[model samples]
Target: MNDFLIPQHVNSFHRANPVAKLLCMILLFMLTLFTHRLDFVFYQMACFLLLLLLFSGHRFWKISLIILPFLLVFIASSSTMILFGKGDTVWWKWGLIQISQESFYRGIHIGFKSVTFAMEGLLFVLTTPSVALFYALMQKAKLPPKYAYSFMASIRLLPMVWEELLIRRNALRIRGVRSLRGGMKWLGILKLYMVPLLAQGIRRAHRVAVAMETKAFDGQGERSYYYPSEYSKSDIWVILLLSAAVAAALLMSILLPPFGITDVRYR
Candidate 1:
């Protein structure tokens, strides 16, 4: 199940102009940050999922599962907070626990807002090539050259990580080595996955260090970029759109403080 939900090795999005993907991330992140309205956030998240469906793989509902556990946690936490929270409108009371209308509102608010936050983040993580994303960030954001190179060193390691995990999984099942009841439990399976993965990871880390040394990766000196990470007209358009979205959220927050627009507030 984890393997299914973890995004596939998709090279499709690579065809999109790197700049376009960057713009999309910026706009979605801006929407996430500036919008205080829960409904707007929810809508934005839905829209992002929709984008994933339309753009790369339309089978998002089948593939996307990471949203579930976090949503469950937030719903539980917020419900507990609201039930015990001190507020003016007490819905019910017991010897040790009380449920208030105010608490209910607050919890629902937090839960819905959290959905927005998580979905906002998925925009960058689920889509967009890491190398291209980092290049755009470092170049346009003016990150220090030495830091960018060091950061990129880690980003470049992901393929190695993925390959190692893939190979390990294949090797285990092939060897016919049953571990703790033929992988009857997820925990048992996780052990099979992790032990070999960790070993490979440690080995890869050492190899990476040696490779970096061979390439003379001394961050103490100046460096040159292989890709021209310069900005274009699309970047300006993206920035302006983001600014407008932020301004709109701020305006709405100030004007409509009473009639909130997000979550399960329909009771």
Candidate 2:
């Protein structure tokens, strides 16, 4: 349980300050938003994906499995622009559907941007632990203890909630209860599962609140943390590495001739 709650470090990147890594992610997000060149976006997406594969400390197949779902995200994000966007060079046209060269380029660019965003976010989530993140925010970002501890409490409760749900499901199966298969199906599920879950959650929350009150956690006085979030030289290295990635992507975009489409906005 302790091991499940606290993730082991995969590499130096995983050990870097959570606050620093979060800030770097935000900076990368801002950079991605301003970038309009399709080639630039592609390079950025590829760079992040490569970093994810390298530092995720998983086998190639495992990483591929993790990334498989983002294919859907890419398709879903780009489809709209490709199907209906306005442009001069029409490739195909039908009733209420249009495809053009500029739209195709724009759609691909948007897809790349979306995938890059997901990759960057996944990189952070895969590397950082919830406990460490909340603690980092509290200590370094000056987040209030009340809010941080509440977030931590919610994280702790999630596994137990999942376990309870499984137990309830098993119990229902043992009792020969089957779900309804019609218009009333969703309502039946809500009544059977959601009600119990909500009731149990409320009870658990009450108990936790009382326990916290008994321990004087409500006080605003300075308190010592069991898991201290600290900054070290590795944080600087993490920042430098991410900055280098951004620079490399930009350089790649500049050196390689763009795919005949520079800015997606006017083209």
Write one digit per residue (lDDT tens) for candidate 2, span 1-267: 344323333786788999999999999999999889898999999899998888765566766887899999999999999998888999999998999988999998999999999999988987887788988988899887888888788888999899989988898889988876889677987788888888999999889988987886665858888789999988988888888888898898889846856799853
Task: Report the lDDT tens digits of candidate 1 across residue range 1-267.
Answer: 134434544533433435565666666666565554564554444554554454443255653565567668677767876777767778889877888776677666666566655654554455555666566655566555545556677666777778878887778778985555544576877888888878877787678777776786544444566666665664555445445554555555556544464433334
Q: After superposition, how far is residue 21 of candidate 2 from its true place, in Å?
A: 0.7
lDDT scores in order: 0.60, 0.86
The C-alpha TM-scores of every prediction are: 0.59, 0.90
The lDDT, on a scale of 0 to 1, for candidate 2 is 0.86
lDDT for position 200 in model 2: 98
Best by TM-score: 2
Backbone atom clashes (below 3 Å) for every candidate? 1, 0
Q: Kindly provide the TM-score of model 2 when superposed on the true structure, using C-alpha atoms.
A: 0.90
